[model samples]
Target: MSRIVYVNGRYLPYAQAGVHVEDRGFQFADGVYEVCEVRGGALVDEGPHLARLGRSLAELAIPEPMSMAALAHVMRETVRRNRVRDGLL
Candidate 1:
């Protein structure tokens, strides 16, 4: 069986997954970041994370890196790739 890792705009094998240097976050650290505890693969403190995301954007006056819908889709794919069933809260 094979797993697909979602990165950037594509699904790739972990070995082939890569992030470009040109990525805005990498280039200028202009994007916000998030790290959550995955418990049994479920996200923990999701509300807080989203709140922080909002605050980060407001503080920097930067648009969100991805639209809400796009972010949800990509995240689902990434979690699927990583096979996380729950996350830390």
Candidate 2:
């Protein structure tokens, strides 16, 4: 079965991970990125994640990805959507 992803405000099917043609991640490689580790259905180190995210944005001069509260919600939902609850912490 296919999974759903919460993108922006929409829960979209995984097969259609679309973005605007002008999105900078692919356009000018203008965005810095991070990979967060998940455990016990939650982020392993969210504090560090946010710190790293902030530093990355600052280094690249990119705007904040989203408000801290909003990013937390999406991170939790992403773990739930991926069904990582059965795994380790």
The TM-scores of all predictions, comma-separated, are 0.65, 0.81
lDDT (C-alpha, whole model) for all candidates? 0.70, 0.75
Candidate 2's TM-score: 0.81
lDDT string for model 2 (1-89, tens) is 57777765787898887887788776886776677777667788788887888888888788886887788788787678778764432
Candidate 2 off by > 4 Å: 86-89
Ten-residue stretch with the least lDDT total in model 1: 80-89
Per-residue accuracy of model 1 over 1-89 as CA lDDT, tens digit each: 46667676778887898779888777887766677676665666656777787788889898776776676567666776678777532
Task: Record all residue pairs in model 2 with backbone atoms less than 3 Å apart, i.e. clashing.
Answer: none
Cα lDDT, model 2, residue 79: 72
lDDT agreement of model 2 with the native: 0.75
